[model samples]
Target: MNKVHYLNSHVEKFREDIKITIDVENIGDLTHYCNLHIENKKVTKIFTECFHKKETYKDLIKKLPDTVERLGLFYLTTVYWIAYTCHYHNDKFDEAMGHCLDSIDMDVPLLNSPHFCKKVYYYLNPIDEVKC
Candidate 1:
């Protein structure tokens, strides 16, 4: 199978897994956000067109590292968004916090928001630490 086709299949499976694991109500919003970003980034056109030529497939393989990094960022962003939504709206604060902390523990670049950082810090180092 061509690399593009293989990558596309894996992505589709991941999407399916996300749909199964995420709340049904949230799936529509997540799909809309992802589709909007894909359209704005022109990533859809690139992947669709790249499969037509052998050279294009090879080129994609050569750029695999960058592709993987972008994909990782996409996955992380999705997880972060779900965690944020769950924490604030779904009353799944502990689960959401665990997801966020797991992401951080993976040593990926941290989210830049101070509010998120503060929440995580407080989560790790509870209020009792300073109460005494």
Candidate 2:
């Protein structure tokens, strides 16, 4: 499997809410197959609305030092997920993506996107289309 599992808490409310996971092997371009697409307009709209949280990123940035310290064996890999989440709706696409590409090259998964909601139902979220 490309990825043994993927957390789906950000999507539909499954019974085992915390157990929401999708399995796809990490070979070839598995982005679409992995269901990372924010397909549902409702979900996408919700995400678009909530994605603009300077407060949240600021909080995370403040805690980054502590958060990093709390990481263990998978620290490097784990941090990118956060970075990805940040860039998913982040305003600073260029900078965030630079970090994301580096993360992916290092074998870290970046789930964030620069794409718009409508296109998210189709492909990668476009950085230039974020509804500021």
Candidate 3:
């Protein structure tokens, strides 16, 4: 993100904010002291709105990249959230499966075993038999 804009917006009173945040100058000196504000609060808030099958939820998820999907322990959480959103929430089965298998690739375990995603939910969901 553009740090100069952040420095101008958040820490308006401090030059240190400008130097460390924008220029990355004397970086080691402010390693622990400088806290750069990226203004990501809005993005974080949007993702925190849980899962979505369509409408606003789908629109919001489209804004994020798949790299973000691989972060945190959200792989399983996101998969199930998608399932619930499609099956019970929005009745958008095809879209949910698309997200579960493709976008999130919730199936890929960054761990030793990649089958982790299927074994947990996709593999056992009786609903998969329910005709798309």
lDDT of each: 0.42, 0.31, 0.38
The candidate that wins on TM-score is: 3
TM-score to true structure, per model: 0.22, 0.22, 0.24
Candidate 2 minimal-lDDT segment of 10 residues: 24-33
For model 1 the local lDDT of residue 26 reads 41
TM-score of 1: 0.22
Query: In candidate 1, where is summed lDDT lowest over 10 consecutive residues?
Result: 48-57
User: By descending TM-score, how would the candidates be arranged?
Assistant: 3, 2, 1
Q: Kindly list the per-residue Cα lDDT of model 3 for residues 56-128, writing each as its tens digit.
A: 4345546554544332222333343443454454546655555545643553222223245334343333344
Candidate 1: regions farther than 4 A off? 1-80, 87-89, 99-110, 113-132
Off by over 4 Å in 2: 1-39, 52-92, 106-132
Question: Better model by lDDT, 2 or 3?
Answer: 3
Task: Give the TM-score comparing model 2 with the true structure, all chains together.
Answer: 0.22
